[model samples]
Target: MTGDEGPSYTVDDALVALGFGKFQILVLVYAGVGWVSEAMEMMLLSFVGPAVQALWNLSPHEESFITSAVFAGMLIGAYSWGVVSDRHGRRKGFLITATVTSIAGFLSAFAPNYILLIALRSVVGIGLGGGPVLSSWFLEFVPAPNRGTWMVIFSAFWTLGTIFEASLAWIVMPNLGWRWLLALSSLPTSFLLLFYKLTPESPRYLCLKGKTADAIEVLEKIARVNGRELPSGNLVSDHEIELQQIDNPSEDARLLSPRTNEIKHPLGMDSNLGGISSLSVLLSPKLARSTVLLWAVFFGNAFSYYGLVLLTTELNGHSKCVSHKLQTEKSQDVSYKSVFIASFAEIPGLLLSAVAVDKLGRKLSMSTMFFICCIFLLPLVFHLSEGLTTGLLFLARICITATFTIVYIYAPEMYPTSVRTTGVGIASSVGRIGGMICPLVAVGLVHGCHQTAAVLLFEIIVLLSGICVMFLPIETMGQELRDSVQV
Candidate 1:
């Protein structure tokens, strides 16, 4: 028997029994670096675009392209990295993909022309694709009881990262220039790589890959790191054995679920799917309905959130205080300071999500945020006092941003471990399409004097998204995970 036919249960049981531990905390801390790095770069454009535009004398269309270029590359990266990490290992994605992204982010600082900057930012985006899975990797290792809470807390880093970028830009952008800001954006890559260097691959991943011995070894490390001893018994899992079956190599040699661990042709002949599709599993009778709804939720979440958040640079201009920052003899960094305050709204939103997710269940809490986000956006369809309008914007930011963490933490919980990342990747790519759409459409509309239409559209789409959440069939709140489950 090959590793596939070895002991059915190995590391998962040990991890579950170990409970929540410090090792999981360590993973969250490391994963936050990638979150910060990518968050900084994604938001970097709002700061950099003005500088690039001033430098190159770019038109509105040209400036929009700069943002689109990154999402275009992100579309490919998010999907591919998820699949690759599932096929190879999450550690490789953290190391190889993030390093490549950091370098691209850093190199954009030196681009000679707008064309080169766009190309470099695209490269930065492709690398950024691998960054989101840091949450999935963390969730896979942590105990199930508190997984939702931790993942929500983890998303706070996205908020913190944005705060860092804004605060740093406020300090340095006036003197050091946008080039320096871009350079600093890439710095987290090296730190993220170093952090993962001391980390182990997910033990659940090792078992699925049939690396029973390796999986156990990692669990021993987890137990030790968590300040506990491995239970004195077979680490093999009874639950996994009940959930998994040996597939006939000739009939279905590859796993089509994003979990992709269903069957292994470790020697390579039957390893990759030849005829089946990973997405096909998500569309199966058992999952098809939920998958469609899930996609809608993901699409709506991404569309409404990024669509609005990205336009902050332009939107902030309409505020009296922000307008003063731009028009007055105020400190040059005042604009940056305003940006920091707007993005800082995400902090309290995440904290609220962390507690609400457990207290209200993922469904109620997430859907509520989605609808609440819509309510906040409604007043923006018409004129209001500048302060009120900005406050409304910040309020919307809190709701949509909270929705992001909630959906992200919830999606993987719905899937078996085998396909969790794949599910997330696909959903995220769909979301990126939203991210791609909003900037192209909304930015131009804001420029063309159709700001009301833009606000209405964002509100309508998100309202539908919240409705989708209400229809979701599964609720993972306070649920234990399934490390493996049969077809």
Candidate 2:
């Protein structure tokens, strides 16, 4: 819009008129690159785990610590980057996180010993933790109607990165070893820095910063990218910009106030309540129930997803035995190939969920997928024949992968903007705890007792989480991001 006199247009018309073909595609591509970088950093640890164990002669407990440490860093990084993004802008925050991640990943490649490796992994976690926050920045720029699809499309890059990592492991591990894989993972981060030059700062963020002209310029760039002409309407005004910048009073007061009743609910006279009022807010009556529900959802999803993925490496090892058996009949490395193909199942799941999320609604889509996952996993627990189990596991993985995507989208949508990143970060941090624990749990399940029992427990958790999800405020579908929860 040119000035204050231009006619108002809906977000959809503005997006379409701007040229949805090339410009939006380019923006998505740019965002996708950063996503791939973040995903690579997040997942490379899984592929490298066995190699690290072998090279370092690490005990099972020590090996678990190494992986968990990175997630610990992620917990720190996610909140830190959110604060930074709020203070600075999304562009600078993205650039800074990308740079830090690249450095940390490269440093991890050269870690001299197991202790150093674990430390570096934690550092890498801090750098990579900014990914979700940056994704939020991207969402802020787009209109709400198109936001779900865009976020879904953006999420596909995560699977693409995982696919890339698996492919690289398939090709490079046999020849170059895992160190090379670790070193190579940092390469995508370099490319993202280059792509970022063409990407503009979030227009909404600019508006919040009182930069009306700059915000307008960013919006024009978005229109140009989408291939639409600028409307001859009044630019967003300073007053409107100021109003947009106003932080939600409820959230702000909660963060800043000294009142104990507002901050937390006392458990009982006998309970050991002390100086941790902020942490206690999580247990308050108004927020406590939702918090526990979200935690269960996150914990269950993480435990199930990571447990299965960690098992993939074991399956890959089993594939070698299958390959050996098939080798008598043929000559291909069929086991490795099977593992690679199975890892790729995530791609289609991500793409399909990306396209279907808004149309289906987050809760329905997520719960349906979780139910499908439970169905798929049941055969595995019965100890079906290897071939059948393998196929079922692949199918189960795809469904769970889609469910994971929905959770990421739903988690942020459920919270208000003031506590949006904080809430998601806390959930993510808790999920990381589950991730850290799942591997050890898997070890016990597969080695100590029965794999079926371990997997069954995971399925039960997923089912419970899905049930909990149904009780959530289901009215979030198609709703605008709010400044406060409407209890």
Candidate 3:
């Protein structure tokens, strides 16, 4: 079996044969670091806003800009990096994102003025934008049966990051200040670059792009690391698989025929299909409905998730049971404590989703979480005791965090390898739009005496998000990763 010949086994077949082991752990650790880095940077926005406001005596609008700038850059980064990973390679995208995030974030600590600080943080956001690619990259290596649980488990690192940021803010911001916090927070991301050499491009991506030999090389490496061997056959190219699909469109085609003269793209189009971008492929008739619904889910999830995060401080501020000394103390201390405490809710949320994601499936797990999250959030619209309000916020955080992780898993699984990152990146970018607007509502309106209206808006959005999840055409739980739209 020469490299040019159609392999007797598929990528999935080889992965199943290898099973999950040490190599998969390595991939998870590497990918998880990216998650941690991105989370810290994002969580930084919540902590830094107030400190900067106190230092510069900036208006509320300016403090809000700090958060919006990052999301704006994220919107741009998510779209661009997705396309980059789809076209160039996932490994390259990972390297670039880590490099950009680490350097830009570190420089943010030394900004001479507020304008420079925002500009630097925006650049950091650009690097942080490729976060969805990590999900796609990690998922491709995992077997279908284990994909949901593993992905949710991987998302736990993100929660760890948020907690770490809160802790770091609590320690540093109260003493060393925001500059020190920024410096310390940005430091961890730089380590990802040092560890980048440990990761390889997605073998599934290599196969779809017709790099069969390179794909095989990666698979073989994985097998070696896992103390196993590839399935006892030549690995199949996506082109060969597509030919079998064409020959018998309704069933799994396993014929190992030689390559044909007519080359084909996975979207059931000719290889020479012109002027079609990955975005266009996603919006094609075959995938358009799923794409739109998934986008809506993404938007709602972001609006509610980030809105609740920003609202934590507001909720804490309204509590009447605070001691007189605490009221007179630095607001940053109280804010960080509330954020730190609320973030713990994500642990149980992640644990629950990890279980439900596999048992109940992705669509059901996500919709259920969104609805439950809405239930917890609704009570906050009315005045309540501080302890009751705190309890409600914690419960709400749990559900929203779970939904956030599940949505990331579901979006990538829905797309073909050719545009997996692109689909995820675009969806994530739409979510950032929600993240951008959330400050205006979560912080702005809440502070402007429209707290009731703001919480009600979040409730409605969360409820609608659940409906969109139900409308999704396919459930990805245990579904084999699709290499092309044709499959």
Candidate 4:
């Protein structure tokens, strides 16, 4: 700890100047594990879907119910946990989600019936729903200069999850069966709780809660770990300054006036200029339009992304569809191999987005990739050869996965710290509506309706999503995150 004799700086200045170091690296490891686990639960249904169908002698509709259950939980979890973290603290939210998800995941494997399985999956989904919080939590600690790149790269961890799921299915789908696969997929989540102990609560979060002394202590720990000295004197933060300014304005002066529609407080209680409430802040004038558009992007992204992911094996062959043991096993083998290969596409996709987001700006990166995804999906619309269709589907997956990464990167950058997690949670919860609908549409449009309808829907949705990206007004390339939502 160096002497507290240097320049008097706000916490933001101290943090930005310290730059990226051990703290960022630790976040990747700690949060990265959570990311991988969340990815696994999201992908688990896709991997286990076919197996569940065969074991329980079920219809595609029931299969969809199981897949969507987790997303339903996630929708609720994202909203509830976002509020928990904002009002209580980030650390509490983090630990609670990890613990609940882990226990639910492990126990879900033992469910005896299809109804029980989906029910348990819903619990797992709720825990997974809190996943967006990890990104916002980690983002506050990172420097803005490389923040977009780091976010894209962080999303790349999803590839490892894809690898884990496909590889697990390849090995166990034959001998161990779907029950064992579910068990194996969830077993690793216990490690996330252990990792939780290693992460410090976000200093920004502490500052927001008015625990200034605790916030400074965490910052010093981060500085020490980074081999840097703290800039001295009473370390201040923008939040503290805002509180002071709002809490103590001059007599007969209302510097932080409420908007036209807001209620005026007697005895000066409007100091909570957090704009009505946490959720209301995003709906405030400066942020409302961006919030709606961003939610549109999230909805389109999940609708297509998970629609493809949860049905990858099913779309490939009748292995999980047919009842003949020998044929079902053989077809499943082929589907698993194909899923493994296509998953490799995600690695390159993440790398491309990591570089593209930095070079192309967010809107262009998302728009270009989404357009390409629609182009690739056109082959499926034409009902091409299996060989040609499979190849195109992989290409489409790469593009959509890349687009997904950019959306996550773009959302956090769009909202400020005051409502970062809230904005993300609301957007994600809306996206999960698409996720919930994905299974029903993916299966119904194919088996119940026609494959052509499903392909056209996917193509149309991806194209529309790309168009939405192009319409966004701002492009957060290397902009710093502020304490207030500034549109």
Best by lDDT: 3
Name the TM-score of candidate 4. 0.89
- Cα lDDT tens digits for candidate 3, 1-487: 3233443888888888899889999999989988998889998888888778767877768888899999999999999888888888899888899899989998999998899999998999899999988888999999877788789889999999999998888888878888988888888777778888877989988887778899999999999999998877777755566576566544223334322223344572233222247778889877999999999999999988888888888667644423243462445566888888988988998998898998999999999999998899888888676567778989998999999999988998898787888889999999999999998888777656677898899999999999999999988787787776752
Model 2 stretches with alpha carbons more than 4 Å out: 1-21, 230-292, 315-338, 382-385, 415-419, 482-487
Q: Candidate 4 lDDT, tens digit per residue, 1-487?
A: 1112444556576678777898788888777778888887887787677788877878878878888898899999988777677666677877888988988898888999888888889999889878888888888888778788788768877778888888888888788887788888886678877767777888876766567799898889988889887776766655444444455554433534232122222111122433137766777677777888888889999999888774465566631234455675567676787778878878888988987999989999999999988878876755555566567778888898899999998998888666777688889999999999989987756655366777788888888888888888778898766555422
Highest TM-score model number: 3
* Worst-scoring 10-residue span by lDDT in model 4: 260-269
The collision pairs in model 1 are 9-236, 9-237, 259-418, 259-419
Alpha-carbon RMSD, each predicted model: 5.7, 7.7, 3.8, 4.9
Worst 10 residues of 2 by lDDT: 264-273
Q: Candidate 2 lDDT, tens digit per residue, 1-487?
A: 2213445432333444554456556667776787887767766666576567666766656766766787788777876775566556677767888888889888888898888888888988888777766666656555567667777877888888877877887788778887899899898888767777877776545554556578777778776666567655545532232233343335644454333123222221111212243234445555567667777778778777777766654443443333243432242244345556667778778876876688888887877888888888876665455466557768877887888888887777665443445556667777777777787766545534366777788789878878877776544567655333322
TM-score of each: 0.88, 0.80, 0.92, 0.89
lDDT of 3: 0.83
For residue 79, model 1's alpha carbon misses the true position, in angstroms, by: 0.7
RMSD value for candidate 1 = 5.7
